[model samples]
Target chain A: MLNELKNLISKEILLEWRQKYSFGGILLYVVSTVFVCFLSFKKIVDVPTWNALFWIIILFASVSAVAKSFIQESRGRLLYYYTIASPQSIILSKIIYNSFLVCFLSVLSLGVYSVMIGNPVQNLSMFFLTIILGSLGLSSVLTLVSAIASKAANNLTLMSVLSFPVIIPLLIILIKLSKNSIDGIGWSVNYRYFISLFSLDMIVIILAFLLFPYLWRD
Target chain B: MKHWWKFVAVLFVLYAIIAGFLMDVPALPILHETIRNLYFHVTMWMAMMVLMTISLIYSIRHLSGFKNEHDIVASEAANTGLLFGFMGLVTGMIWARFTWGTWWVADPKLNGAAITILIYLAYVVLRNSIDEEQKRAKVSAVYNIFSYIMLLVFLLVLPRMTDSLHPGNGGNPAFSTYDLDNNMRMVFYPAVIGWTLLGVWMMTLKIRIKKIKLKKGL
Candidate 1:
């Protein structure tokens, strides 16, 4: 199972590599969106507003990058996976792949956002920790959601409709957490948020693992 | 005989409605009379939660057995849950308007409630977007489980980490925290059971209607 998961994760990475346009497209997406934010706000003077805008950009970027990638996995590809892999392996690999994918994309987005908009984040390490947690939570839920949506009409709108509500809660916490980081608040004020965020991620990952087998079957 | 709970539900609900208005003693400032809403407004949320939990349980059963009957029941329960959620939202808004002087506020619990509504609305939309029978059932059940857990994270886990305007959340006086006394509990507990049973009754009725339609080739 470990080997199968490793191979599946590598297969995803290889596919993303071979189709560099998709990878480059997500990068361009991040840069362009940050540019748009920069254009509108000129320069956000308020730290909380800046924090909120940054996470919002990351949210949209992840939605576009991760979910679209899952949607494009193709019926034939899923069928091929269905033949060779256990459902647990498939979902685990997809989640692992998307987590790293979105994690990288969001980090890049953060860089672009801070460059264009001015970085006010006071605690760099704590903020990075939140980003890592944020991406994992976002990708795990979106991967399961896209898998469910893919089995349906394949309507792209359905993906947004399904994912946004589920994602909003995570976003609220992430914004609060990062806001704390931007304010340079000490970690004592943050352990609760950290615990909640970590537990939330665990809950989502566990749900995806347990429920994917049912979804993968005919 | 087996349907005794329906009679009990009706009896309790009728009593709650009548007494909820006529028998309130607390006279707190701002929320003096409106405290009576605890029986009506808050119970809607309780019922919604109970109904959604039932829906989640049935979704798991559907996934395990691949039974169309269980899927139908799951959807119906979720439908009823959504109805209760709407009731809760409107009542909450009304309650908020009178007390908070606004139709909405940026609070964690309110945001959580809004997210809960959206998750189930997405669930309903997901069910509609799929065309195949077995595929829809299987796919929706997986989604039902996944979204429910995420919603739980928002509703249960995240809110505890933040200060909120809602009672039982922060230090705000809870409709007379000192006097959530037996007087209130007498009505509140039965009201909760009454509304939840009423939601279940509605769900079961819809399930039977669906089964009949299926039998009739509709």
Candidate 2:
């Protein structure tokens, strides 16, 4: 199982590497969106708005990036992959790959957003940690949802429709944790939220892992 | 015995409605006369939550057994639950407007309820988007279970994380602690049970009609 998971993940990464423009397109999306926000708001906004705007950008960007995890696959390619890999490995690989994509996009967006909109985040490290956790949570959920949507005629809009509601709880946590970071609160004050966010991510990943196999079998 | 519960539901709700209006309520500031909304507004939410749980349980059963019947039960229950959810939201809004002087508040609980409604609405959209019968059942079952867990988090867990204008969460004085006087509890408990039973009865009726349609090859 472990070997298959490793091979599947590497395959995912290799495929992503080959599709350079797709990855680049998401990065470009992040940059352009931040630029637009900068143009609209122009002046430096308060910490809460900055935090919310950052998450919203990351949320939509990750949706587009992760929606293709399964939606872009042809039936023939999926069948071929199914012949060689376990269902669990396929979902795990997609989740891990999307998590990497989201983390990278979030970091890139944060850099551009801070430069353009002015970063009000007081505790940069804590905020960065929240971004990573948010990415993990988002990718796991969107990966499963994309798989479900793919089975339903590969509808991208349906993917977003399914994901936004499921992701809102995680988004709320992410926003709150980042707000605490913006306030530069002590770690003690933030630990409860951190634990909740981490646990929520775990629950999503575990659920996807258990349920994807059912989705896998035709 | 089966139909007996339906009569009980009608009786309880009728009792609640009449007594709820006529019974004396604790003279509380702000809430004042509107305190009576506890039986109506809050009960709708309680019923919605119960029906959604029933739907979630049926989704799990569908995944396990691959039964189309289970899928119908899940979908119908969700449909009924959405009705209650919307009623809960509108009622709560009216209550909030009267008491809080705003149509909406940035309260975690309120936002959580709104998001829960969106998640379930997405479930319905997912069901409609899929054309293949068996695939639709399977895919939607997975989504139903997944989103239900997220809904639980939104409704039960998220509210406790931050301060809320709604009672019983965060620093707000929950009805359990101060309000919910003996007079109110008599009506309130029955109201919750009555609404929940009524929601379940409606779901069963929907399921039976769907079954009839299926039987007629419609």
Candidate 3:
């Protein structure tokens, strides 16, 4: 099972890299969003608000990037071929690959955003930890939801609609933890948010793992 | 055709009206006139949950096999769910305006409910855009299941996190205590049951209509 999972993950990652346009489009979207935020809040962007904007951009970028993962799989019976391997393997691979992509984009965007908004992080390590944990929850949920929504008629809109509600709890926790971390609050002050976020990610990933088999069946 | 159910539904609608009007009398200082909307809003939310649950069941059935009835059931239930969701949204907005002095606030409960409704609306739009019946059914079934799970997360899970002026928040206690007294319970419980039955009846009728159209190749 581990070998199969590894193989599927490598395949997807290679496919992603080969599709340069997809990666470029998502990166450009993130950059342009940060640029717009800079222009719009040139004079009044505070650390908290900038923190909020940073996550929102990352959230939307993750959605856009992950929504097409399954659609691409369905392009020409690729989903069928993958199922011949193992549905669990396929889903796990997709989740892992997408998590990597989302975390990278989130960090990159946060760097650009901090430069643009000029808000120095009081605790850079803690902020990065929060982002990493939050991105795991975000990417896991988005990958599961996109798999479900990819087969929908309006994949893009349906993905957004379906994912937003599932991710709201995660978002609430992320925003709280990120805000506290940015404000230099100790982990003790924001520990509940971290635990909640971690638990949510685990619950969702387990549920998705159990449910993806049903979705993969012909 | 047995029409007794319709008669019973009509009687319940009349009862709802009477309960709503009585709820408006000035004797209740705590709730006052705004309590009238509670009959509709709370009942609509209950109905939405019932319909969404039905949709989830049908999606499960659909995913298990290509049974046409399951697809029909899923779509009909989703339609009814959307109807109740809209009613819940409008009623909640009006209640917010009167009680909170705003048309809408980012109150976790209210915002979560609104976002859930939007997600389901996107489900319907997705079904409409697809031209192939089998593909549409399969895709929609998947999307419906995803959205329903998210709806549960939003409506059930997220509210526990933050403080809100809404009932059932901040350790202030939930409405099930004094807010739902015997008098309100008499009306409220029946309203919930009646609306759910009505939604199911509507969905059955819609399924029959769709079957007829399919027979005619429409």
Candidate 4:
């Protein structure tokens, strides 16, 4: 299973490497959005505003990015994959790859956003932790929804509708944790947020692992 | 005796309606007489949760067995759950209007309620978007189970973490913490079961009707 997962993930990466423009497009998306925010906000001095705007940007970028993950796959390709790989490894690989993509996009956005909006985050490490968990949670849920929306033959709108409810709680936690970190709150006061975010990620990944096989069926 | 549970469900609801109003409540300051809404409003949510659970179970069963009946049951249960969820929302709004001096507030309870409603609505949308019978059932069932667990984490776990973050509490009463008086408990507990059974009854009715339509080749 582990070897299959690695092979599948590398296949995804190889595909992504061959399509450099797709990755570049997402990177440009993040930079352009932050530039737009910078133009509008001028310079956000409020910690809460900075935190909220940052997450919203990340959320939108992640959604658009993952919406393409499954929707773009051709039917013939999926059938070929179905024959060669276990559904669990297929989904696990997609999730792992998407998480990396979202994390990279988030980190890129954070740098641009802080430079443009002014860095107000007080505890950088805690903020980074929030970014990591937030990316994983968003990608896992969105990847599953992408597969779902693709199956339904509708793309962006359906993906958004299907993913919004599942993502809201996660978005809330990410915002809260980042808010705490922005205010330089200590770990003792913020451990619950950390624990809940971690558990939420675990639940999504586990559910995707279990449920994707059923979806794999034609 | 075949429909004995249905009879008991009606009995419990009637008892709750009569006793919930006439029974003495602890006359808290803002809640005042509106505490009576507790039986009706809160029970709607409890019932919705129960029906959603039923839907989730049927979804899992459908995945396991690939039976059309399980899919019908899962979809109808979600439909019934949405009905109860809307009822819960409207009733809560009315209660909140009188007590909170607004029809809506940025309360976590409202957030939780809204998300569940959206999730199920998305489930319905997902069902409608698919053209193939088996594919619709399989995909929506996977989605049904996926969203249910996400709902659980959001409603059950997120609140505790957010409670300290927002000490204002939005004037939202923590019923479990301070405790419900014995008198209210008498009606409240029964109301929970009564409405939940009523939801299940409606769901079964929907499933039967759907089966009939399918049989008629509709």
Candidate 5:
């Protein structure tokens, strides 16, 4: 079962790479969004606000990618083929793939954002920890929502509608943590946000694992 | 045609209006005039939950292939649910503008309710987009079940992690603590029951109308 799942995940990753547009489009969207934010905020966007903006941009970019994760499979019996393997495996593979994608995109955005905004990173370790925790929460959530939304007809709009509310708590925590990190607030002061975010990630991922097989079944 | 149901509904509306005027009758201090909006906002949320619950129950039945009535019940309940959801949003917005001195804040309670409504909205959109009736019913039933779980996670579970000005947050007692005294309970409990019954009543009428239309090939 593990081997089959690994193969399935690898296949999905390779397929995504072959398509190219999915990754390229998401990267382009992230870069353009950052540019737009820079244009609008200009010099007025402070460090903390810029940090919040960075997370928001990453959040939307992650959402865009995950929302389209299953679109390519919608055309054929690709979903059926996967169901023949195992629905749980399929969900796991998608979650893993999307999580990797979101993490990568988040890092890329963070790098570009730092350069563009010229905001000083006070604590590299804490900032990286925040990104890791925050992206995990986001990827788990987007994976679950995308699994459900992909089965819907209007996948994009439905993804937004279903995901936005569910993700607000995580978004709030991420924004706070990012802001605190940018402001050089000690982790002791903002540890609650990290705990909340990690707990949310665990709870949501477990729920998704339990619930996703049902969705995959006819 | 039972006259009592409509009469009761109208009476409740009238009582709500009367209560609105008497909201500042010097007896109630904590809630004050904002309590007037409570009659509408809380009632709308109760109605929305009732309708969504009905939708969920019927979705389960539909998925299990109990009967076609389940689909009609789900659809009608969703329609009624949306009505209450919209009212909840509007009323809550008004309440916030008055109480919080702003039209909106990302308060957990308000945001959770908004997200719940959006999930249902997506459900309706999902149903409308699919042309095949059976497929639509089955897929939506699955989505409905998933959404209810998400709703619980969003509204009940997530709020505990953060500070919210809304009731039931950060050591602050929920409305049930002091706000829902016996005097308020008299009207509040009845309001919940009455609004729920009316929601179901509207749903039943809608389902019957749909059945009739189908029978007449309209």
Candidate 6:
């Protein structure tokens, strides 16, 4: 199982490498959105707006990036995967790969956002930690939602519709944790948010693992 | 004989309507007469949550047993739940406008409730988009389970993380904490049960109609 998962993960990575435009397009998406925001505001905004806008940018970017995790695959390719890999490994690999993709994209966006808008984050490490946690949670959710939406003919609107509402809870926690980081709050104050984010990620991941087989079979 | 619970639902709701209006309520500062809405408005949400849980359970059963009957029950229950959710939202909005002087408040609890409704709306959208029967059932069942977890986290966990205008979350005092006098409790508990039973009855009727359609190939 471990070996199969590793192979699947590498396959996903290889597919991204070969199809560089898709991944590069996501990067370009982040940079352009940050630049657009920079143009709109034309001046550094308050900390609250800065934090909110940064996550909003990351949220849309990650949604576009992760929505393709399943939808981009042709029917023939999905059928091939169904025959070759177990559903558990398939979902796990997709989640892991998408998490890596989103985390990298979010961190890149964070850098670009800071450069363009001026960073208000007080605790850089903690902010990055929240970003990573947010990435995992978003990828876990969007991967499954992408799988579900793909079955309905890769409708992009359906992907957003299915994922946005489901992602709000995680988004709220992420924003709160990131806000605390901006305030440079102590760990005691921030730890519960961390636990909540982590637990939500685990719940999403476990739900995907158990439910993917049913989606896989049909 | 088997339909006795439906009779109970009717009686309880009738009692709630009469007593909820005529019964004396505590004289509160902001919510003087509007406190009676708790019996109707809050119970709509309670019924929604219960109906959605039933839908989630049927989705799980569909995944495990691959029974189309379970899928029917799941979808119908979700449909009925969405009706209750909409009612809850409208009622809450009216209450908020009266009490808080705004039709909308960006409170976490309010946003959570709205997001919960959107999640289920997406579920129904997902069902409609998929044309293949078996695939629709299986895929929607997967999405159903995924969204239910997300809904719980959104409605239950996320609200507590930040201060909210809604009672029972954060520092706000619950209606039950002080305002739900014995007079209110009698009507409140029965209102909850009555509405839930009523929603379930609607769901079962829809499910039966769906089952008949499936059997008739209509």
Backbone collisions counted per model: 0, 1, 0, 0, 0, 0
Q: Lowest-scoring 10 consecutive residues by lDDT in candidate 6 chain A?
A: A42-51
| Candidate 6: regions farther than 4 A off | B170-173, B177-180
- TM-score quality measure for candidate 2: 0.96
Best-fitting candidate, measured by lDDT? 2
Q: Write the per-residue lDDT of candidate 2 for residues B11-117, one digit (tens) a residue.
A: 99999999999999888877889988999999998898888888899999998898999999999999999999999999999999998899999988888888888
What's the candidate order when arranged by decreasing DockQ?
6, 4, 1, 2, 3, 5
**C-alpha root-mean-square deviation, candidate 1:** 1.7
Report the C-alpha displacement of residue B148, candidate 4, in angstroms.
0.6
Highest DockQ model number = 6
Per-residue accuracy of model 5 over B22-84 as CA lDDT, tens digit each:
644224445556765666788889888888888888887876774777988888899988998
How well is each residue in A171-207 modelled by candidate 6, as lDDT tens digits? 8888889989999998888998899999999999999
Question: Candidate 4 at residue A127, lDDT?
Answer: 88
* Residue pairs with backbone atoms closer than 3 Å in model 1 (clashes): none
Query: What are the per-residue Cα lDDT tens digits for candidate 5 across A22-141?
Result: 779889999899888777877534676677678778888988888776654654566456546877777777777788888889888877776776666687778888888777778877
Cα distance off (Å), candidate 4, residue A105: 0.6
Task: Please list, in the order the candidates appear, how each scores on TM-score for chain B only.
Answer: 0.96, 0.96, 0.90, 0.92, 0.88, 0.96
Interface RMSD of 1: 1.1
Question: Candidate 1 residues A1-218, lDDT tens each?
Answer: 99999998998889988999988988998899889888888999998788877777777777787776557877788778878999998888988888898889878977887788888888999999999998899999888888888787855888889999888778888998999998899999999899988988898889889888877768
TM-score of each: 0.95, 0.96, 0.89, 0.94, 0.83, 0.96
Separate DockQ for every predicted complex: 0.80, 0.80, 0.42, 0.82, 0.40, 0.84
Judged by DockQ cut-offs, the docking class of candidate 6 is high
CAPRI classification of candidate 1: high
Between candidates 1 and 2, name the one with more favorable lDDT: 2
Candidate 1 vs 2: which has more DockQ: 1
Over 4 Å off, model 5: A39-45, A74-84, A147-154, A187-191, B1-34, B64-67, B94-106, B165-182
Worst 10 residues of 4 chain A by lDDT: A113-122
Put the candidates in lDDT order, highest first: 2, 6, 4, 1, 3, 5
